[model samples]
Target chain A: MAKNKTFEEKMKELEEKVTLLESGEVGLEESIGIITRAAAIIKELEKELDDTEGKLKLLDLKTDEITPLSEDEA
Target chain B: METYSVSQITKKISCLISADTTLSGVAIEGEVSNCTLHSSGHLYFSLKDEKAKINCIMFSRDVRNIDFLPEAGMHIIAYGRVMLYEKTSTCQLQATVLISSGMGILHEKYNRLLKQLEAQGYFDKEVKKPLPTYIKKVAVITSPTGAVIHDIINTIRRRNPTVQIILCPAAVQGSAASGELAERIARINRHNLADVIILARGGGSLEELWPFNEKELADAVYASTLPVISAVGHETDFTISDFVADVRAATPTAAAELVSFPLEHYLAHLSAQRLRIAQATTLRIEAYRQRLKVLKRPAALTQMLAKNITGHRSNLTTLRKQLAKTAETMLIMHRMQLANLQIRLEANDVSSTLAKGYALVKIKDKLLQNKEQAALHEPIDVIFDTFRLKAEIVEIKGETYGEKQNI
Candidate 1:
């Protein structure tokens, strides 16, 4: 089986890349490239968040049927 | 003889016995009585018949193959020479073969010993201590000039070079060896130098390794605070010490290997620990970084605020414009509707009909439209748009001229 990279490792690497890009010390040629890579990582992180949100929504949907009656009806 | 010294007399007696009787091996059968196994690995006992009894002695080397314990009251068949002890001036049997009466006696003795130890809780699993994975220091009790020490040292050095070895030289065989071994073990315990102790020796015949089977040595091993590893004889060789020690290894080399950890295994363990720590730290940093990133995004905040303001202003402006347009359209429509209604009202006006040239004669407020209904000389009102005349119907004129009239 292939080894899996943990969430922390991936996040740390992306954060480091972002820091290097934002430092403004790198040459312009490399800066753009690093920014592009950082943007991709950010997209991946966003997708992960979206997937988690979707799962939570599914859980909510599963339990959405049991609504309470209004005061007037009761 | 009367003039001879004591030494001369003893020497003369010894010579006479040696010359008179020949030393020969013999087999005798009797019940063992007053049996004693000395510390020197020698057997001292008495063989008794119905009417008589004889003393017997078996040296350590001769009794090497006796499988069962030789005890008093057990019937045994013995083979050895009849020798005379000059000091005691008694003849006795020097036994070689001391077989028990039957298997029943040996089995009973084994069960009795096992039961006694079990009752004392010696075989309880809870009393067993776990062996250390890496022994920092190991004390070995064995003969100084034996292959056991050399083998243990070689195996330990090859496997783990850092472990310290302490040699406790003691006799490993013979009768006195058991007491010596127990004493040395106690001494080691008092010093408290080593983390573990290995009672090791090379393979030997059963009788040669009988010292390790002594109950005193077993008790000493059991009572020692330090963990003991017993490696006596070969793989199939088991003794009382083996049962009492914390761990039992088949050979000296195996005992050394069991106590020490290889350097490679340690390095691997350290590496795995480092990886876990590194991964956990990285994850923690990333989690904080992500939170910071969310906080640092000013664009999202500004965009959200601008969107809210724009939406609110647009909604207010749209509401206002719709309200004004609705009011204006309603006013224009209402005005047009009012004008149309006025036109309809004028079309249905009675005054307009009157202005269209219709006239009538009335009696006060009642109009008379039929002239026949008017009586002659009757006073009536003439109604017109401009004039109202009071007149009397003077004549009844019928069929006058071309039109019929009643006036």
Candidate 2:
């Protein structure tokens, strides 16, 4: 659940949970919990996808500093 | 210094030229002129710039390594040692390696570095990190204002807009481009900015793409903590960075695809998982419902009871028939007893006797059989089968043959 984790990490987590649920060994309460977690992860993934903003930031070659390029510049 | 003969002087000059470290193994880049291939498998030529020319020779062994046969006006870079030709008493270079200039020079340099790096295990498959399945952030190192960056940005945006693109601008061509690209890669690594990095450029002449072939850039790609996708030129062109990188894409747009997953793919996968889960849960609940139906118990018991009731109803019908038969038999037995008693009564023939012997008399509710026993007068009753008469004994009779007493 760490914000620093990449989208791939979250996808892996969701996939593992789904696999566990499908194994049929989980109790009813545990399966419900897995479904809840899976739904949450899916919501997060969807939010991330919908929130995509193509923001370009420029890096100063000499100083290694970054400057966000404004939309008007394009 | 001692006075010497001409051969000694020439030999000493050769020694002096060879002894100088800078001249001993020097490299000169220029165009070749008066190129000659001798019968002894030796190549003789003049390496010249506009300002000066130096006589150069390559023996058969080194000549075998040169890809192209040298002709007049072929530019080349020759690496060899300066020595004196004793017969000519002149300084010349003995080239150990000869490479043609321009595209040939770039190709030669690129190949030599590639081989060197390959031998060093820089491009080992074991060292390559797999690209992430879902890249959330990408750091792009390329010239900022070019079709290369534009293609990359547009491709990723069109496919998967969620990926964060951090453009680390650098020179894509010229002498400083390689170092600048390497530096930008290092900077991105230091910041831990992106999940993957893309080193990209548009197609160009080999000279324009030379920077991508630099060892420094290749090493930078190799040293990156994040996985890298190299897209330096058209599909036909391959750079050292392409070989060193974790993944190679034919063009800048392809690199973008390598880093990001298409949104449609993720959506479809998610939908499939959702459907599978729904089906699984439905199946589980239905199975449970079936199990519950079996465990309910009374349903089976009621079926058993209904079966037994059918059996008991037939048993009761048989018992009723047997009871009726026994009752009929008892009635017949009672009737037969009554009939036998009536025959005895008939055999006694009380009515016949009464008819033959006239009347039978009773005095004081008793029948008198002897008149001698009678006292005075008494009322008597006589009965037959059809009628009865009441009477009184009024006379006494002495019974014996002729004795009779009256009172």
Q: Which candidate comes out best when scored by lDDT?
A: 2
Model 1 chain B weakest lDDT span, ten residues long: B269-278
DockQ top scorer: 2
lDDT of each: 0.70, 0.83
Weakest 10 consecutive residues, lDDT, candidate 2 chain B? B398-407
Candidate 1 lDDT by residue in tens digits, B1-407: 36987667666766665565444667788988888889999989999999999899999988677986676666788887776676766777788877766345544654565567768876566777887544566777888666787788778767766666666667898889999889868877876757788999888755567788777887788788888899999999877688778888988889989876775675464445434434544555576688788778998677658858978898999999999999999999999999999988875674667677866678646767565776878888876677778998887654455454444
Can you write out model 2's per-residue Cα lDDT over B287-313, one digit (the tens) per residue?
779878876889766875886897889
Cα RMSD, each candidate: 23.4, 14.0
| Model 2 CA deviation exceeding 4 Å by range | A1-5, A60-67, A71-74, B1-100, B301-407
Query: TM-score: which candidate is best?
Result: 2
Clashes of each: 4, 10
lDDT of 1: 0.70
Per-prediction TM-score: 0.46, 0.58
